[model samples]
Target: MEDNDQRLQRIKKLETLRQLGVQPYGTRFEVKDRAGDLIRLHGRKSKETLEQERIECTLAGRIVALRRFGKAAFAVLQDGADRLQVYLKKDLLGEQTYRICEELDLGDWIGVTGRLFRTKTNEFTVEVRSLTFLSKALRPLPEKWHGLTDVETRYRQRYVDLIANPSVHEIFITRSRIIAAIRSFLIERGFLEVETPMMHPIPGGATAKPFVTHHNALGMDLYLRIAPELYLKRLIVGGFPRVFEINRNFRNEGISTIHNPEFTMLEFYVAFADYTDLMGLTEELFVRLGREVLGRTVIDYQGRQIDLTPPWRRWSYHQAILEVNKLDESVLRDRSSALAAAKQLGVEVDPNAPLAAVLNEMFEETVEPHLQQPTFITDYPIELSPLARRKDSDPTLTDRFELYIAGREIANAFSELNDPLDQRRRFEAQASQRVAGDEEAHLVDEDFLRALEYGMPPTAGEGIGIDRLVMLFTNQASIRDVVLFPQLKPEK
Candidate 1:
């Protein structure tokens, strides 16, 4: 809701502009330079130097602040992430134009034709020679000193948040640069970027409840993708050896500081590579990103210093569970003992779950939080990973690894399962779970099985949550802070 007094004042101004035959909502205004660039180039120039040069420039921006001095005024014009002060004089504008200038309120967009000069306070200033009405802002901007402080309001009205908080703008800017850097790094390594369908016939990639929608013409249901794993692998089978995609995945799940229903992920696959190869590649990618984006291998994340240098700590699943819970190895290998251990740790697990599932539940509840630094947890149980290849030495465990940073899983990678018979068996097991009332179980994708039968190369694939990565790089604690518009409850 707008303040009544301010609304009336703005409305009166709008009427006045209309009476003057001026269109309050404006069109294009030619601009030669940004306010920031103008300052950067001539900020240090003396007033005498600027007056002698008589540099003329045209700029357009919203008026953020105004200081009136009867016949003269100084207004702050903000263009994107930069702000500049403009000096307007009644004598130069004459009576009619002066009145127009006087009636102009803060938050209005205007184009200024000006000459650059320095004020006595050593600040770079623009002396307005002429002004053009660009756009009228009815609602005033948020209070300058406090800005848009309410988190809910900030997320709800992100445009206002961008205007009020420069830091927020910078976060999104950094996010773009980070993504660009990732693309550059991958492309340099001979990886081709590709697009995959956001709607999947079967959610066969990961174990997560999906958002379902109907294609009325097709007379069937489609699910918003939970992961791009299955389709990316199909591309691999089609002979696109190295491929990557950066896109959104939707999950019907609980919201939290770290989780969003719709999120972005970077999924990539490379042929002739195993999980170990991917571990090295992951390390290289992180180090390169840290240096290129942050200019340092070490970053400060939520008050803790995280080192992104090579050779992050690696711990096997059993080792991590044993280290965190101090449980005997045999306890994790037996379903009954694992269930009892999970109960003792106050972790919830399905009574009918296998030992691997129970152990994983225990690890999530007890161990995941302690991984504050960059670390990799490897060699997950076969029951826990249906798509990862079985370990050569241990058939019960798969060649998979999850990268954790700041006590959160940042990336999951595995050696791709290429054996057609093995994939069929895995899919069958998953279908059984689906029939047994597990809503999040993967549905058997026959087309994907057909692709696997045609033979996919031994590949290494990984999915890194882009939102979580942005949160880490931006030092944001919540996923909402990095996401432009996160999901929220409906207002009454």
Candidate 2:
């Protein structure tokens, strides 16, 4: 039978109750106690003893299960903690209330004022003195044993999903705690939290395409921010020594199990600190949060134990990549030799690609998945880091690192570039890439360049993917699982 047809029949039955001088949809209900409290209070009492005491309490919940046996009826009502059985008998409730019980269906919201007692079957229950309908649910719940299983519908109708599966509610609850912990951790460390513009005339944070929108009145085009990196640096130039922002970042890119179109990102900048300090901070924060949130430093993410203890292993990006490809680190010094090594190791190398770009591609395809534990892969090639400060010992590399856990990049940090001249040169190089048809190349933000001319302090900055971190802490498999409203493909 059609679901709506069934709902219509229930609605008609509910209207009949109103016509018979009973309010089917009540305006207010004063619930004195919860179902769980009632059960706990009466579980130890003897049935005969409780029947003599007749403890009065009022409770309201959604009707989950109902069974009618002529004069007597039992209905399971679910409150927040758990469900409790409510017994209705014609002998006790009289014919008028018994008639109302016959019209009540599963999924309707109801209020029951009753005496706490134990049933003959050793079950704790509420023996009703009065019953009322708080709200009439026209539609029935999905089946008792089976639930809403369609993935698209689950995401679209999230409220129904929350009602069907209690675990989904816990996931989002943990997500909020994860973010709150991050903010608290940072604020406690003397970091000033700030907000930056979401729409920018030039998006220069990271290498990614941006969602473009036009301002009709102003006759100008703006891009949704890919990262808050560049603007946060501008704040540093304006003399905010320690700052961070927990905000939404939109990326016009592909979505996957680990990637979302719009996601939360935590960007922080520390003046005079380096990537090394930031690494220590990241490790300590995760370990502390693990102990605080889940009561353990060891988290099981997708069946792998991720230890967030201090002193996470640090390896240079090139070193890790070479080990994955079974090549010696010495081969990384020469471009031609590196290409030859890649070929010998069966790794694809684009001849025209920059050396760092080829190496990064190889690492992502080969080594990233093997970094299953908390580890920092540091010292990336200069070609891959336009905003990072060049290492003094080796100008060919940048003072940067990325934290990888469970095969995904969780955080990116670097000793930020503060020299205006060097910054301009880097932007010009990226502009050249743009001219060569690289759509993902960074744009030259003139204001950011102008801010750098004011002589910003030496600073270290990091951007952590908040959704991915929550997934790790919550033991969720996909980014969508942690995100309440993940972007999805529109139905045809």
Candidate 3:
């Protein structure tokens, strides 16, 4: 009823405006000043100073607050960045302009010609000489609704949420700065930014189910890329020495505090660099971001002070599992023993599951939660890393490391597996797993394999989850808070 009344009131005013030979919806106005810039530049000027200068300016914004008296009134205008007070008096303006001001609504957009002055209370304000109605808002602002507290409405009606909660603007602005900084950092290091395909003929990058669609003309099924790893690596084979891509990846996955089906990633590859070299680069990148974004190496995330200083703690995959669970080497020596140890540790696993999958699950359950500070768990088992290079001393383990911060995996890096023969074997192994009910297993991309035969350089590649990184920097508790429009189910 309130909304309907607002619409009717606006219509009545539109007729009144037409009768007065006024354009309710106005055209071009030469806006000479912004509220924020004016406040910043001349806010300190005294009442006498403003009166002496007689500074004339034109401004435009939405009417967020208004107050009316017998023949005098005050209205607060909210511009793009800040708010300023505008005093409208009928006696100074005769009666026609004051009537136009009276016709104004809370959410209406207007342009005003005014002079700067200090209010009697010493507040900096714009004394309006004339008002031009620009646009009429049908519905009112979300004044009565608690915009931030209601998650469903907050995400659903983001426009209203933004107006009701002014601080929400900072979150998106900070996210933009983070991405721009990443691009600048990589570009300075001779990394060439490139674009990759979002649709793939076959999903071969990461082990995640894909969202598939069909191309009508081509008459073939295409998968929304779960990751751009494969296409980026193809750039390596094409002789691009250094490349980086920042884009969205889609996956058919369940929603959670840390997981979003569609999210952005920063993936980069460098030739002649191993996983160890990339680790040091990763530390430097975060430390640089820390000083640039927050002006310090320490950040408060979810009530914990996370220090991103260099030389973070490192642990081998097997070592972390053993120390966290206090298990003997013999306990995880073979499939049966590892299965028994898992059951004893209360980590459930399918009895028929491969030992590699069970052992990985054990690490996730027992060790990941304790990695609060910046830590790197390295040298994953061979079966778990199909695209990573094998370690020289222990071929059973691959040269890969996953960086964890605040008990969540923020980045994953590895030495690329450039040998076509070995990569083919690993792809076959994953295909077998897929046949046996593991839908999230990698598939053999013959084109990617053939590209491997063309010989890619020994390179190090890494993917950093941009969403989770933004969450930590912004002090947001959930992934939804960082994402502008996170995936959500329809209203029932």
Please provide TM-scores, in order, for all candidate models, with all chains considered together. Answer: 0.96, 0.90, 0.94
Candidate 1 minimal-lDDT segment of 10 residues: 139-148
Q: How far out, in Å, is residue 409 in model 3?
A: 0.8
Per-residue CA lDDT of candidate 1, range 198-307, in tens?
A: 99988868889999999999999999999999999999999999999998999999999999999999999999999999889999998988998999989899899999
Better of 2 and 3 by lDDT: 3
lDDT of 3 by residue, 1-492 (tens): 878887888888888878887887788887999998999988999999999999888999888888998798888888864788989888767698888877888878888888999988999998888878888777777656434568887877777666666677788878898898899899999999999999999986898999999999999999999989989999999999999999899999999999999999999999989999989999999998888877889999989999998899999999999999998887556888899999999999989877888888899999999999999999998888999999999999999999999988999999999999999999999999899889999998999999999999999999999999999999998898888888999877
Stretches of model 1 off by over 4 angstroms after superposition = 144-146, 350-352
lDDT of 2 by residue, 1-492 (tens): 778888899989888889878877789788899877777767788888888897888999988789999899999888863688999888998888788888888888889988888887978888888888788888878764226677776776676676676678778888888888988999999999999999989987899999999989989999999998888998888889999999899988998988999999999999999989899899888987898789999999888899888888899988888787788776676677777777776778787777777677778888898999888999998889999999999998999999999999999999998999999999999999999999889878889999999898989999999999999988888888888888999866
Clashing pairs in model 3, backbone N/Cα/C closer than 3 A: none
**Could you tell which candidate, 1 or 3, scores higher by TM-score?**
1
Task: Give the C-alpha miss distance for residue 418 in model 2, angstroms.
Answer: 1.1
Q: Residue 469 lDDT in model 1?
A: 92
Q: Using TM-score, rank the candidates from best to worst.
A: 1, 3, 2
Q: lDDT of model 2 at residue 447?
A: 90
Q: Which ranges of candidate 2 are over 4 A from the true structure?
A: 17-58, 80-82, 88-98, 144-147, 330-351
As a TM-score, model 1 comes out at 0.96
